[model samples]
Target: MGWLDRLLGRRRPRPIPPPLWQQTVARLPFLQWLPAADLARLQSLSEAFLAAKQFSGAAGLEVDDAMGVHIAAQGCLPILNLGLEWYDDWVEIIVYPDEFVVPRQEMDPDGVVHEYDEVAAGQAWDGGPLILSWQDSQMAGDGYNVVIHEFAHKLDMINGAPDGLPPLHPGMDREAWVAALDGAYDDFLARVERAEARGEEALEQLPIDPYGAEHPGEFFAVVSESFFEQPQVVAAEYPALYAQLALFYRQDPLARAQAAGSSRSR
Candidate 1:
């Protein structure tokens, strides 16, 4: 527990009310595969999250308990096994009604400066608040999850700047992690380049989101979203990276999804 938590009277989190939890879990299809024990832990985590962080509505979006719980659930998922301590750095979440634009300035190699607006579904800052679009927040299924993408950035920023790499655990091999992610990232970029050369249709059919190839940090966030939402895709396309992620997350989403499939079939 941090001094801030104690000061704010948020050190001990109460359990999520059963009714709110039921409604939240029911609305979020992606959380259906979590084990019962894990779900219980997630409830506690959500409570802690709601207590520790402040949520603000933007652009006239009303932030309510249900909405807050939903966000908290998604935010807590990535850190379910990792623990809430990983997210101790930040304290606020700002949600817009839809996609928001932020002005950005970039300097060219020739020293020319360009300024423009970049539309974004979500953004995470180092030791700062997380910004998200409520429209994007409600669009999770198949492979898109704004909450996961932004929180994944939080994980990446734990050590320093947003690179694809997060702090490795004791048993995890850094060299192996580097080799796996780097090789997969290179291969993905080559695949995207080929797809672009072929056509738009080919680009759409690519195994994972091409946005991942944008940068190592984006790759980590994009793939993390895919890993949880569509683990089969990650397992099929980037088996090595998927394996490393499974090792890091300490959860086998592929196997869980397969089990769910079998249960539904029977």
Candidate 2:
């Protein structure tokens, strides 16, 4: 708790009534698309997340109720099947107004020291910090969600360094999760290589992020965007992938987003 937090009382925010909270949720695409009764439950879940978590803005970013609501909504989406307790292991959220540059040091394959840095939109280190860029955050849509990506990493890291596996709940089969994600990951890898071979676009409306092609851990995190932001695309092109995510997140976003998309198309 910081001096400002203690002074202003933001380590905790009192619960808004269910009706009012649902109205707050109605502003979001993911939330609003849920069935009305489910949306109400989501409101209760988000309220718990908001009350229990501490949010702080870094690098000249000012935290506020609206921002809290936004992050809380997205963060809670993944664990709706579980609870806010899914996030109980981590304690802080660090937000920046835009991208942040992090210095880097590495030894190349040649054993020569290399140093470089690049501005990143967001990053989530296991059991450490969840970092975000408000610019990309504010623009989250169409299955492109930085918050979901990083938080998914946090889930993946629950056991250790993100290896595309989050701690499984009772009765959930670990091998099944692994097999499903591995299949999708292998398919994405082949697509990337094929595109590279033919000099074609490698990431034209990919169901998962191109960056996910880097590693299984990254694939889990990036595909988490589809788990929340782009359920329809994933459901349409990768229903099994959608099914695996539906089991993990414990939410039926395809049903909701499909309904929303159908309404829009109609």
Candidate 3:
């Protein structure tokens, strides 16, 4: 057994408290939109996640049961259909009270190296601990989910370097995945450039995060945030990409939202 398994006192996970599970689900509407069976599965997966990982609070922030469960709930959504084993390679999650700055150094084409601090809400290191800003993690609505965004990066890193493509499941086409993400990435990059030229209004009007234009990997993570929180927007703006994501995730969130809406209307 692994250290985590020993720490938890068993190989299996203990259940999350009923009230905490309900409260957590209520806070995340995308999770609440799930069918009862799926939601239960997610809860189970989250319990396993909590058992397998260790969470630490940085900047003097205290990590509590509620905070842990909340983060676990959101983080486990992407792997609800896939298993917790996808995340087994990493064991630590570090949380900050708010945005944290990381020093960065980059070399230009001319070989000039520059150093600066970059403020980030969340970060997933390749084969290392995932980091998050609790303040940003609370901003889960409107396609700005830091928890899901970072978890998606964790998924992307599973194969090797994150380049907008992770290891596809059996029978999934690599060329098709490339085509879908590449086509959308190119178009989105152009749109962001155009919007930047116009002003803040155009940038704010973007259906998805303009930061996605930073790189193909960032595009995958950003659109993944949209895929869960704002599925309809993804479905409408990039149907082909949405289809690919659904195939990969094995969950059709847009369809779930539509069905939930219809049920509520009845």
Q: What TM-score does each of the candidates earn? A: 0.93, 0.86, 0.96
| Model 3 lDDT per residue over 207-237, tens place | 9999999999999999999999999999999
Off by over 4 Å in 1: 1-11
In angstroms, give how far residue 184 of model 3 lies from its true place.
Answer: 0.3
Compared with the true structure, all predictions reach lDDT values of 0.87, 0.76, 0.91
Q: List the residue pairs that clash in candidate 3.
A: none
How displaced is residue 228 in candidate 3, in Å?
Answer: 0.6
| Candidate 1 residue-wise lDDT at 7 | 24
Lowest lDDT block of 10, candidate 3: 1-10
Query: How many collisions per candidate?
Result: 0, 2, 0
Candidate 3: regions farther than 4 A off: 1-11
TM-score of the candidate numbered 3? 0.96
Top of the candidates by lDDT: 3
lDDT of 3 at 220: 98
Q: Which digits, one per residue and each the tens of the lDDT, describe model 2 over residues 76-179?
A: 77887787777877777888999999888889899998889978988886677788888888767666788888889888888888989888777778888888
